[model samples]
Target chain A: MADTLNPPGQVPVTVLTGYLGAGKTTLLNRILSENHGRKYAVVINEFGELGVDNDLVVDTDEEVFEMNNGCICCTVRGDLIRIVNGLMKRRDKFDGIIIETTGLANPAPVAQTFFVDDTVKEKTRLDAIITVVDAKHLPQRLIDSAEAEEQIAFADVIVLNKVDLVSPDELAEVEAQIRRINKYAKIHHATKGNVSITELLDQGAFDLNRVLVHAPDFLTSDEHEHNDEIRSMSFEAEQPIDAERFNAWIGALLAEKGGDMLRTKGILSYEGDDRRFAFQAVHMMADGDFIGPWKDGEKRVSRIVFIGRNLNRPQLRRGFESCQVA
Target chain B: MSETADKVLQTRGKTRELDAFVVKASFDRSGSACAFALGDGEVAILRQGADDWQRIRAHEGAVLALATDAAPQGWISGGDDGRFYRIQPDGTVALIAPFGMRWVENVTSFTDGARTRLVACSAGKKLAVFNAQDEELKVFEHPSTVTGMVFDGKGKRVAASHYDGASVWLVASRSDTPRRLEWKGSHIGITMSPDGDNVVTSMQENSLHGWRLSDNQHMRMTGYPSKTQALSFTRSGKWLASSGADSVVLWPFFGGGPMGKPPTELAGGDGINCTYVACHPKDDLVAAGFADGLVVIADIASARILPVAGPGRGPISTLAWSPDGAHLALGSESGFAAMVDLSKK
Candidate 1:
């Protein structure tokens, strides 16, 4: 009953995306149930271009036709901006916002909507993007749908979800593959859609200025063909990783077979301070710098995701573990 | 055809276009005939046996099919949407009936004695009959999506074809007791002979058929390696012609007429778009409308190309010369109609 971070005029917009049947809605419902009277405006999707039985598929008791709680469920109708703007008119009633886009819905235009639309951007800031992945079906889905690959590429926080469904071997394979596609995204291994709310919001992954400075793109002027089998695996090492040995291993891997690596990223573990350092790589081109210390009093563990083709997980694990401060 | 392998490519005309917007099956001082294009969204009167052009923007949503009588008043066209409009030579447009649907698949006319009527069907799934006077004669329903439709000789009966099956119905009554011709094949082109006694159908699959409406007796004309795109009955019903797999296969009635010849082998022959081939009602002038917007009028005896000039910026949708044999009208996919003065060029 107190005016919190989201007061009358300063609520942030968070985008939710994942592959089809990837537990996005389940996680959202859990959040809503856990934090009810907290008052967050919600955007839910209906059918999209790829649905066979394309009809409205949301199960909220709230009458969407006369929606008044800042909650807007837009069906296949192209009235997204209209619905969101209506909610913004009564902004005093809500705390923040969450947009549940369709599984295959491309998030670029959704992200751009925050900057492009004149009315809503004035009232709210884009907060964070949380993507859920079906741990069991991701491997096959990545091969079948282009939307899946893009979902991984644009993730801010990827929930490697549905861990209960995948076997131990399959879970390991899925985690390694996720890291290969996105190096900077914070990965959270989740089961039954369980994750800490503190971890979900305000991590500042949506801060474009901060990201560009810490990670430099080597192939900025050149076109890079994607290595089909190589995947990017990214992690954040809370402590310093042995930069000399890790660089040697990455250099040797690229020298003999850089074409086999699609991408890789991590926060380097420095030799002394128990603080996270960051890095990103695209194929053989790699450049990174230490941004700032990870927030003190936070869990001091390194987090990273590697994304590339034919990623050597055994060698990468051994190589990363070998970089521990001795 | 079992499957529709239609490759529609956009093309250009030399000066303008070779096409028709609305084709009415109409009547004039000439006789019982069909008008192909519309004028100012009105009527384009084409008599059965004359070559002159009549300007009559006489309908709404453009003309689809025209009818004719000795006065040449018998004709109908199921419009672009779903409304079926009828046109009289005096430039009078009447709404015969509305199918209350989405797409008007086809509206073709055939003469039955002195009382000629037009056959109109829309949404490719509903059928109806309107007389020369715009009278609603009968209406029927088709089982599946309609691909091709035609009225048999005399206009006493109709033949409807779909992606699954084909049927023949008597026009006298809105009868569903159609002689269920067992040849259940996906058809691309369907036609009733001038006498409306036999139905000729073409498929995208690999063969063409001739079913005798009398008892469903039929003939299978073979040889196409790919798909048969066009099929038609010669004016006299003495010859049956088909083009698919890039070759013209003419099946002569009785036993034999001529062994089919490839289009490339025609005298002065070049590759043709081969959209629809229409045989002249009066003579042996066979005009094949192509995707290149070229209407090649081939004299079967010479096997040569006689390019009839017309209008279009794309492929010809359907091409038909005035029944009187005066002006040739070419219909294009771009929704414009082109009329070529046969005597002009």
Candidate 2:
């Protein structure tokens, strides 16, 4: 990730994506009219075109511009590039660009804009990709729609908005689905956009360092085979991971067949002492973190998750628990 | 809980972004024990005790294993570089032996026990033994990754637990076969009672096992809500404490006899799992680190938690008391190793 100099000059792109009826626009209105002074140039593909009632969540301005292209991932991606490029040309005209995508856009292609495209990425960096999901409908969406799947898959941050209507069990299901799609994204539950908008913008999200640290277990390179039911599970134990056995076990597990591992993250704790150890893994890469000393009254626990289609829970559980002093 | 923490350590040379290099490994004490292994088959040791600690080039290639022997002043280290070294009191690291292996991960030194022994295990099944003098005494092969190894009381027998299974191998004497204690499935933790009569282990099988070494019988402790990791025994070996799911469980060790139900229990922080448990070497006081960074010390007798705060908010990884049992040394995932002296701090 490139460093920002003028920082304010760096364009902020807000991605609104989530399962249907996720109150994304309700949240967007708050971002647009919030007491903040920063000037924002809004980009919405289906903003007014969708014909949803404006009565529910009011828009900041009727100065809405629609994209002729389809979803943000396909046609509007280039259009987004051109629009952002043209806007940046004007001096201090717009401080940032906030784009709201249809609930179905796979953010990968949209995210690829900053990394792949040369011109638009250079002028305007991705600020935040926000996804709003229907708290009540998450379970059905996960069980039904592929678009709803991608909406969560590529979220920079997630807002599980409209918690007043959904039950705790439903919320848990929604969260589980979100975690299943993208485990690294930080999800904050909110009752509308009642949450603070300060955390929304200028967060420097397209920042890969923190995201990468969160997802040491993401295996992007290896493609999944036919089977898909096998989900990668994670287990964290606050016990001292016999360092020697852990390294060897992970190395061999990856060496023998990392392609099948899916992903794993472990915050490890050892016996006889109080410290937390963090470890993560993808197909070929594995790393660790000695976060610091464990807090007072804190238990030494290592939380590990392994995601994959054909994950052998029995085998993984055995290997994972074996990490301690045993 | 610091007003501010200075960057006491960093890489000698900057190569890439600081965030990506989040300092994965960290160890510190009033000793020269912190080290990193290089892929070039060598290792560099940095003394965390001294501020201006000089870097000591150790091993030929990627340093694989390191340990502070029973003597807190001296150190023993091994590496994939095929060389081992011993740091004497004079600040000199002398090459002690050669072990040509892919990599060695841990060095378990129990040289002070009645039958002194040093054991090291590598990435695969490579296991080697050494005398107190650092001589290679023996080598054996295992089927899976050998993750856990420890010397039972008096160091008469050496037991190594595996990722898939667990076993106890006798050291000092050569011809006797290792007494086998099998806990199939994802087995994570293992600990022996001070009397060397009972053993407690955490399993990935969603259960815990208590084995009586005297009779070779075992009892599976169940009803855990989730995965548990920490296990410890009282100095007298009468009380066995195992923390798991959401509480610290205490079961009497009657030479692996039937533990129909736990005799005592210590409740954990709400919603946070108790991950590790350390019984005071000489007392019934127990420490448990939780998932949310709550380190609660509980009384095994009263089942009341004493406020022996943990090291940091991060998951506490290791909690070691000084030989005198006055100071609690804590290690963490964030590269913070702290010594909380009961008398001083």
Candidate 3:
């Protein structure tokens, strides 16, 4: 059977999320008004956020529904599935799609919709989750709202807008806080949401090939303050991992603590295997495959990162270390 | 592929290559004409013997829904342009309701004696009902955006599927409360058994959920490989034919309502997923369209399969049987459409 009902090529969908007044609307206006020489169907949560002159702007309700498959964290955006299906009928009219989520919404359901729906998965690829943060008020928002922390934790690209509002010391502190929550996101500083559209769209951030490329220091063990409810933890092992042991350990770990683990990504070198195994997870759902053969003369290092709440760093490290071949 | 089926398409079929995706095709009540609603906001109508299709620019955007209008002998269509329109056989389009920004997602009509009632739902919670004269009768509110709507056999009650469940309402009832059949999932499509005893909904999940209206008993039909997008009740209401699995998944609706019985799969096993299914209006046969663009007719009793047209250009998107069961109309996502005159065979 064909894996997708769609034709060969899949349209890329970039999810835009941020707290209210974090320059999300400004960024959207810029994307729509700028002569990017591309047609994009933008799905926004509010209708009058900006006077966007684009012909394909769609207002959507943030209707989230838990899947009937008994996985609690496997919720999906019902409205988005409907809108995306409708937009696909006019697939030729748009080069790509961008979804602007509500400020207070959880980005997990929006991200999981691309993973859960077979039709959505086949028709559109989740290019990246771009989260915009107000550099001035992010510290207060992170302290008050869990959604703020989550938007940062789940982001593949973070646009620190309103950078001029904060001092250099304050900016560094805010960036540190963001790093403590999500170590791998590509952070771009912007003023008035004036970042290049290239950084936002078609990043292929979810692609396994680009997974570790964004995090150059992915394999390095860096010390950072981990005081927040949601923080990042990483582990590196020099020895090649046992495929069976690694699968069992990761599977059980995700099953038990996946809800608390907002995002998990790893590139591993398995013992006696020529190809590197790339693994990714959004809550309880996980996907992995042997991406390609390891490059010649490259060090065989297996690294994993988990960004979530109440992460038992020591326990997770022991579990991953135990997967190493004797 | 059967030779007879191949011959049917070769000799009796009228094919057209359109400019945009064919969203839906429907035969009129007289079975003398069929109209195809396209993604390019146009309606193409072909008379029983016409060599060319009379095209009408019906809406400003893609037509999202289309259904046969019985009393007027035309078609009622709703489009993303937010307009409800009626297209006559002469290629004249009349605007019925203009909902400025909301996409009219579904449209249906039913006749009672001489009056034709038009029903349409937009992207939100309202389902509007209008009379044959194009005057609004009543507006029914749903808990969420109405995804699918169908009138019962008697035309007295209308059932709408939306998020979390389906709702059945008495059309003329002054009371605002509808009989809500609660299910905890997104119900994207709905169908009513010919006898109006069962209301089944195709869910966002890869399964179908149904309710026996008399006692509110739940009937869960699972195990589909993909989401069931098309559903049809056999003429006698004995079987509910659905597309999603490799074969036509026919769940028995007559024998105590398919609660414990396994479905009888037909015309598949070749691993090609069926994308659409249309039951014969007057017989125990089903025409199924597959992902590989193959169309086949399967007899429920004999399990005999006959190929019709494809392996065309794209997966079949829509299928409709003439009210007389003499003609079958089908279209694919790649804009290939055909009407097969089974009557001559």
Candidate of highest DockQ: 3
Candidate 3 regions with alpha-carbon error over 4 angstroms? A1-8, A207-228, A237-244, A269-277, A289-301, A324-326, B1-5
Look at candidate 2 and tell me the lDDT of residue A20.
53
lDDT of each: 0.55, 0.56, 0.85
lDDT of 1 by residue, B221-263 (tens): 6666544555766687766666553434556654432224222
Ranking by TM-score: 3, 1, 2
Please give the distance, in angstroms, between residue B230's alpha carbon in candidate 2 and its true position after superposition.
Answer: 3.4
What is candidate 3's CA lDDT for residue B210?
Answer: 98
How does each model score on TM-score? 0.46, 0.44, 0.94
Worst ten-residue run, lDDT, model 1 chain A? A59-68
- Please list the residue runs of candidate 1 whose C-alpha ends up more than 4 Å from where it truly belongs after superposition: A1-326, B1-34, B38-75, B116-119, B122-124, B173-175, B195-197, B213-218, B221-230, B243-249, B256-269, B310-313, B334-345
List-wise, what DockQ does each model earn?
0.02, 0.02, 0.58
Q: For model 2, how does the per-residue alpha-carbon lDDT over A243-288 read when each residue is reduced to its tens digit?
A: 8888888888877765455445556665655655556544434555
Docking class of 1: incorrect
Best by lDDT: 3
Give lDDT: candidate 3, residue B184: 94
Shift of residue A200 alpha carbon in model 1, Å: 26
RMSD per prediction, one decimal?
A: 18.5, 22.9, 3.2
